[model samples]
Target: MVAASGADARKTIHPLFIRVTHWVNAFAIFVMVLSGWRIYNASPPFGFEFPAGFTLGGWLAGALAWHFAAMWLLALNGFAYLAYGLVSGHFRRSFLPISLRGALHDVLVACRGQLDHAPGRYNAAQRLLYIGVILAVIIAILSGLAIWKPVQLQALTALMGGYETARRVHFFAMAAIVAFLIVHIGLAVSVKGMLAPMFTGRAEAPR
Candidate 1:
């Protein structure tokens, strides 16, 4: 076997802990969706009423357990991501392109299929979408927690326009995440040879 040389020790732009945390967050979202749906089915929400007959799971008790447990997992994953970004200096690279005017311009360009030529770690459109999704996740967690522990977080619920409004906002946040996932995965697949970086830490393209 050949001995390792200095060149073998060089670092590259591959998936780091932040990327791993992001994927874990994605998986946690999936689990949350399933458990949340089960909970919703047990008490179907139509405008306002939470009917018991809609439940498809074992019972409301089980559904609550699953939902809260999945929620904690999601929250923990998000916290870990935040800590990684802060500790590793990855946040600067990820969040640099956040100008509203520039993002809007990029959005228009993307709509016209002109983003292929854009350069940067994240093009304007990607920056807008990623930032928006992060905000959405934050809102989702806060609203959900308020609803989950209404008596404990009554002030927060009221801040979000009362309990009923908080619930609606929480649902909207979940929808945003689902929609983002569809678009994000589609982009990942459409890009040629993009999967290796996350596992190995070196992106195929120059950073």
Candidate 2:
């Protein structure tokens, strides 16, 4: 058995498929969230509505157009990601076990400013977060479908506890996804050189 050379040990790259899917997913989410907000404003299930200025697509019809288009993009990309993860063992290698104790320990270390990151390797906390956000996105997609075609998807709507309940579920799922993005982006920007590797795919461990 041979150990990796110093040069090889110092560098790694994100897979091309992972990088491409990640960026596409980011763009799709941005479009979906803003357009969905616009659609929500039309009915306002709750007492308040999103400000028109902050939402996409000026009007309800226009918003629906954007929302549906982005939804298809998300769905297709998600399928590809899942397929790759399963076939390539990426899911098992990257986020398997879902250890709560390990994640909590990582959080504690991070609080003490002791956590260190390695390229192409996720810590316990990160693994948990990635899995959680994936679930949240899946929830948002299902609930959105329930809301979109209640009559045609009567069983799904009923499974979600009726139309109104589904809307609330959808909104909260979107909120969870948004919250994850905030932390994810904050971490990328705060950690030196983290953001660059995500875009360029190549990563180098600083000495």
Candidate 3:
């Protein structure tokens, strides 16, 4: 019994540290999105505004306050997670060896509803999706900073094709991230017991 328990303990799929940082990042993103919507509504780039009920804060100033606070949390926490993921080899184990062919196969299988997951491992589709979203987040941050400080970060604004372009980029990046989030949430709920490991850390050992 003792030996079995020891083996089971090694099967943890989402370590406690990962869980903590993941939740913190999620919260930060949640706040940033809602507050960002409010900020965007003040001078919508697309000529339409998010429903006030779906936004954070009562007005532009309040939204800016919340957005800036959450932006710091997201940036700091994201850096820590990225450092840990790289140094601990977690990224290697979980999201690696990506290739066009492999992703295509996964997509095809997924479309057929025949895709499956290996315990404690990511499928190609999951890896690609995660990678894409990470990039999107990075883009959002850069474009947002440019929009938030066009005069101060003149170089960044220029890199992003000036202030007007940066705003559009930020909007599109946020939209992509939101779309990925919807799909991610749907999969988590639809897949049997898939969401438990993130909270509990351990999962059934692979046969």
Clashing pairs in 3: none
lDDT of 3 by residue, 1-207 (tens): 445666556578887889999899899989989999999999887868999999998999999999989999999988888889999999898999887789899989988989887668898889999889988989999999999899999999999999999999998999998999999989988887678888888775444
With a 3 Å backbone cut-off (N, CA, C), the pairs that clash in candidate 1 are 13-201, 13-202, 13-203, 14-201, 14-202, 15-197, 15-201, 41-54, 41-55, 42-55
Decoy 1 TM-score against native: 0.80
lDDT of 2 by residue, 1-207 (tens): 124444465454677798889999999999999999999999888899999998999999999999998999999999899899889998998998889999999989988879988777899999999999999999999999999899999999999999999999999999999999998998889888788777777675554
- What digit string (tens of lDDT, one per residue) describes model 1 on residues 138-165? 9999999888778988899888888888
Against the reference, the lDDT scores of all candidates come to 0.73, 0.90, 0.89
Candidate 1 error regions (>4 Å): 1-11, 46-61, 117-120, 205-207
- What TM-score would candidate 3 get against the native? 0.92
lDDT of 1: 0.73
Scanning candidate 2 in windows of ten residues, the lowest lDDT window is: 1-10
Ranking of candidates on TM-score, top first: 3, 2, 1
The lDDT leader among the candidates is: 2
Query: Lowest summed lDDT over 10 consecutive residues: which window, candidate 3?
Result: 1-10
Q: Give the residue spans of candidate 3 off by over 4 A.
A: 1-10, 205-207
The better candidate by lDDT, 2 or 3, is: 2
